[model samples]
Target: MSPTQASRPSTGRAARPLAALLLVAGAAHFARPRTFDAIVPRSLPGTPRAWTYASGVAELALGAAVAAPRTRRLGALAAAGFFVAVLPANVKMAADWRHRPTPYKEIAWARVPLQLPLVWWAMRAGRKV
Candidate 1:
């Protein structure tokens, strides 16, 4: 191994688990309406199906990219963007009194705190060799 590669943190250990999580989460988003009800903001207008699928595809791709050392930075950025984009869904779920998703309650609230750490972890792991 080169000096740089040897000095850098191990990306394989940290990044692969995150990548797997992203893949599973993205798949769930894509399959949501079929396996579960739509929890997206009904007030957002237009079809929710398109948005969900698009985000899922993005997440899946980004996750895979992050797992590859060459593309880790780009993947980290993508993951951060994905997390930011989806945050509103969680906020909407919590704020909409009449439209609370049953199983999403604790999770919706948990996301706010969890997001920062996840983002940080991704960035850190992505930078490592």
Candidate 2:
């Protein structure tokens, strides 16, 4: 089989789940913080309130873009980049280890692994498109 044909099935199967996951994660980013405090990475310095909202909005837009077949590749790349960009927040959270709406284990350890799959999924989604 050719390179194109060989790669088709792997990517196509991944797109839907990846898109759905991105959408939900993006929504959560926007919605989860209101009920919780100290989510904006206290280490960021200065008021981070606006940053949280802006990041949430960006996530939502990227998620929607990833779901659209025509734009999915660009969107996936954007989403992946966004994940990388926000990783410092995760590091800060782990470092300070302060109050959390969820358990520290869940937020820090479990969710950290999820980032790997998210990145892979985004790349796969991009390929499928």
Give one clash count per candidate, in the order shown.
0, 0
Each model's lDDT comes to 0.73, 0.69
**Model 1: runs farther than 4 Å from truth?**
1-8, 34-37, 42-45, 97-104
Candidate 1, pairs of clashing residues: none
Q: Which consecutive 10 residues in model 1 have the weakest lDDT in total?
A: 33-42
Per-residue C-alpha lDDT of model 1 across residues 9-105, encoded as one tens digit per residue: 7877778888888888878876675431254666666677766776678878988888787887779777877777667776665564345565666
Model 1's alpha-carbon lDDT is 0.73
Pairs with steric clashes in candidate 2: none
TM per candidate comes to 0.76, 0.73
RMSD of each: 3.4, 3.5
List, residue by residue over 53-101, the lDDT tens digit for candidate 2.
Answer: 6776787788788777888889889888887877776666565565655
